[model samples]
Target: MKKVLIISSTRNSNLDLSKDIKNYLMDKDELETEVIALEDFELPLYTPTLEEQFKSTESFPKNISKIKDLICSSDVMIWCSPEYNGGISPIVTNTIAWISRATDDWKEGFKDKHCLICTSSGGNGKNFIKGFEMQLKYLGSNVFDRSLIKTKAKNIEEFEFTSVLTDFYKNIFSE
Candidate 1:
């Protein structure tokens, strides 16, 4: 069975959201699902200096390898995060930076993988969805066009959530 990796950037609402998604997708006989909260990992901010230091010492954070392996082993990824300043949250970006740097190929974890961007944010989350979609596509992911957006003013309806996930599942696994 293929694996579905749900990455949550926060431990609060976003983590709850990731769990919901995992529960929804868990029954699929062809796939196994797991949820990971980025907050659980201790990753330093990515900088050329820090990268050099890690490279020189050959001691990148242990969590980086764990995350990279999860991403690389999975066939699909569901990204759950909150918008920060009309963009991707720092944790999501930081995780990606570490993963990219830790891998032999920068896109090793993302290339040819299927990804669905989701958010539970204070705002509408359009910028986050669009911006992260572009970044994931650049890294060689097949990003789903539709997203699951739950904002403070508007929660995702049950039917809509199911529909989006159904469509995304078909998109990734269609024969």
Candidate 2:
């Protein structure tokens, strides 16, 4: 079975959203799903000084390397994040920054891999979703167009979001 890694880039209530996505994906027998909360991998803020240190040492921080490996190993990636200040949360960007620097071939970790971006936020999640897709595509991921968004009004009921996510997975698997 293909392995799918779902990355939740928020803490607290957003964790519930990520769990919902995991449970929905689990319903499918075709793919084995794992959920990784960004909070679990607490990385230091990236800096040029740190980059120089890692390069000179010829090794990345253990957590950063581990996350890069996880991203490379997975067949597909699902990102559930929140919008902060009209953009992706810092945690999400931080992880990406670390992963991009940790490897010789940054794009290799992401290139052509199936990717889906979703968000649960105060308002409609369009800004985060759109911003994230731009970055993901730039990194060479084959991003899916239909993204799942849960706004304050809807807030992602279990059944509706799950059904949409399941259908999205089915379509991706079919293709």
As a whole number from 0 to 100, the lDDT of residue 102 in candidate 2 is 72
- The TM-score of predicted model 1 comes to 0.97
lDDT of 2 at 89: 94
Clashes in model 1: which pairs? none
Q: Looking at model 2, which ten-residue stretch has the lowest summed lDDT?
A: 155-164
What's the lDDT for candidate 1?
A: 0.91
lDDT of each: 0.91, 0.84
| TM-score of each prediction | 0.97, 0.91
Off by over 4 Å in 2: 157-159
Model 2 C-alpha lDDT per residue in residues 93-153, reported as the tens digit of each score: 8888888877789787788888988888889878888899999999999898887788888
lDDT of 1 by residue, 26-112 (tens): 876788999999999878889989999988999878888888898999999999999999999998899898888888899989999
Colliding pairs, model 2: none
How many residue pairs collide in each prediction?
A: 0, 0
